[model samples]
Target: MTLSGGNARQALSRRIIDTCKAMNASGINQGKSGNVSARFGDAMLITPSGVAYDALKPMDIVLQELDGVCAPGQLLPSSEWRMHADIYRNRSEAQAIVHAHPTFCTALSCRRESIPAFHYMVAVAGGVDIRCSDYATFGTEDLSRTMITALDGRKACLLANHGMICFDGDLDRALALAIEVESLARQYHHARQGGTPVILDDEQMTDVLEKFKSYGRQPRD
Candidate 1:
């Protein structure tokens, strides 16, 4: 059944807050740097701009519709709301979006590099590599369009000279993917320091992608 009323709204509001706190605590985020959003009905529940995640309450979550109209709320939505909204409009499977500037990911992004297929797990982003979007001013429609194009076939992408963005079917998955992006970024940085790490060929990456389709599912008895 479709959830409604104050109970439903409050529950989702709390989830958004919790997800933000998790992002900060998990090292994928620092301070109020990152923003999070989740799909809720015809609108999206997103983090309030400039508020520290720990200080957020259920009432502080901002709910804005896809039509650009925001419901009455206690605070302003994140400045990057356009990106989150655009992601929802472009990707039917994306239920949650997380944007952050983890140390490694941000460093790589500043260098305008994408995480390559040096590791098989890179397939988790749904491509041969996590593409880096072209540099664009943050919070601008131009940036949103660039990010949308970068995310064409991937679940995540690094915002050139900005940070990283990740989305999944739910908040937990979105947050986990953000963490994974940072992990991959760190590993890739180290790999380059040692030498040109051998990258997995398209054929090998394709095989890994196929395996990921059913990874962790139990076998039939």
Candidate 2:
């Protein structure tokens, strides 16, 4: 099931479907509130709008242009495809995209507080802080603009007043990052109740980044 060769497109589709199902089961996102997609050549395989994750079939996925045009598909692509499409087009390194309203992450985003660099794993987000885009109506050009701004040179970002969007060179990495971000958000909230949480200094953060590089597991796509 490795997505390393010509059949990568099929692998991408299956990964999208499976991740969507797992997200639903794990309660990271419920109902049809989230969308998943992976780049396949000039096109993308995306979850269709308003479809239940449990009922999704590979064929139920939609094919669309990177510009957001629906390919010869029976279902409409996810309404948020515009944002996802724009991210892939703008971030050449991105290979997969995930949009979900994980409870704690969404809660933190709504409060206008970005996730700070409180934990070393915060570097997993590509920066000291996981930037939060300004609130914009969903599925609109404004939202797309906000997302692109927040995601510049980053692997993941929090959507203002909404949710989280995490993409990477691969689907598994993207999914794992999404989970980690949520965990950090929850930890932050709990720690704040105790007192101001101590954050790592810039030099310490840089050292951690170097260590991650040595391990060679940093998502570099």
Candidate 3:
């Protein structure tokens, strides 16, 4: 009942692969350091680890169940697969996940800095600022727990001394959010070199958040 086979899952698999390559092409991810996954049925379709995106094919994607079981595939899931699984289980609204080590994001992350609302678009992440989780070793349940806490009510968060994670209702939106988050991180990085950014007040951020509810692409009536 969940696009388990036939053409639907195949199409979904291809989209996941393309997004993985797109993540690299967009410069938000370098090499295979980042990972992408999309929710399907009770499982998720995620990119395999250590596989160069350019060399990736649809068949190479790993199908991971929420319970930690991955369908037989030619390669293993990304080392960060547990994080992806945990997010889906914790946040039912999350349909796609994107984790990347962008230049600016990673720089701030290394400093364990959070992106304040120096810009209005910070509201795009569903908050007044992009939170940075307390550092935890990657690929551990502890890391996922910390990330889940940091991500509460927010679509994206920075992993302390690591990188950033973002999720949305679908693959394209999740990818787009990742790119935007990186841009915000870059602007914040440059802003910091001068002085502390003047953050937007909670009231202003709340207004912007409400406006975002109907902003961006809209579905046809």
Candidate 4:
């Protein structure tokens, strides 16, 4: 069922809070370090900065426009709001975004490493490889720009010396993608510890991407 008006905004606010808590519970994020947001009309609803997820009320969510103006009297939006706003502006398909400092993803990012197509599952990111953005200070326009570049043609990317970010058609999928990206990073780390991992070829990844188009879908009548 579709909710409209105030009900719709309230529901989305709750979902955003739920996703933020879920991020911590899933071990993909820790204490107030990550941020979550969802598209809302010409504006976006984002988690409040430094607020505990468990303490987040639906009313605590901040509404900010794409052009960077935020509604008055609400708590400030996440420090990474600019990044989320820019992503939504540049990528028409991004309905939700999740940014986190998952352990494995952060370790990889600290080295400024991108996740290559060492496994076929890399195609889950909508690319053969996930690029790491060039280093930029957190919460800066420079960071947003670098992230946009890294995210080109991909649903997720690592922020250089920072963490990872993912977006999707909704909050649930966006959070899932973040978890998946961290898993890939963990697996890649282990593979490297043993030796250089074998990377799947571009043709193989292309085939996998095609198969992903129908993956997990119910059959049509």
The runs of at least 3 residues in candidate 3 whose Cα sits more than 4 Å from the true structure, single-residue gaps closed, are: 1-4, 217-219
**lDDT of all predictions:** 0.91, 0.85, 0.90, 0.95
Candidate 4, 128-217: lDDT as tens digits: 999999999999999999999999999999999899999999999999999999999999999999899989888989999999999989
Between candidates 1 and 3, the lDDT winner: 1
TM-score of each: 0.96, 0.91, 0.95, 0.98
Q: What is the C-alpha RMSD of each candidate to the true structure, in Å?
A: 1.6, 3.2, 1.9, 0.9
lDDT of model 2 at residue 8? 65
- Candidate 3 lDDT, 112-155, residue by residue in tens: 88899999999889988999999989888899999999898899
Expressed as tens digits, the lDDT of each residue in 1-221 for candidate 2 is 35555366556677799999887777788788989999888888899999898888777888789877775635998989998899888988888888999999999899967888888888887776788899999999999999899987678888999999989888777788888888989998998999999998878888887777666556678
Report clashes for each candidate as comma-separated counts: 0, 0, 0, 0
Candidate 2 similarity to native, TM-score: 0.91
Minimum summed lDDT over a 10-residue window in model 4 is located at 63-72
Which is better, 2 or 3, measured by lDDT? 3
Cα lDDT over the full model 1: 0.91
- Residues 1-221, candidate 1: write the lDDT tens digits: 76688888889889889999999999988998889999988789898899999999998888888756786645888989999999999999999999999999889889998889999989888898999999999989999999999999999999999999989999999999999989999999999998899999999999999999998689999
Span of ten consecutive residues with least summed lDDT in model 3: 1-10
Candidate 1 residue 112 Cα shift, in angstroms, is: 0.9
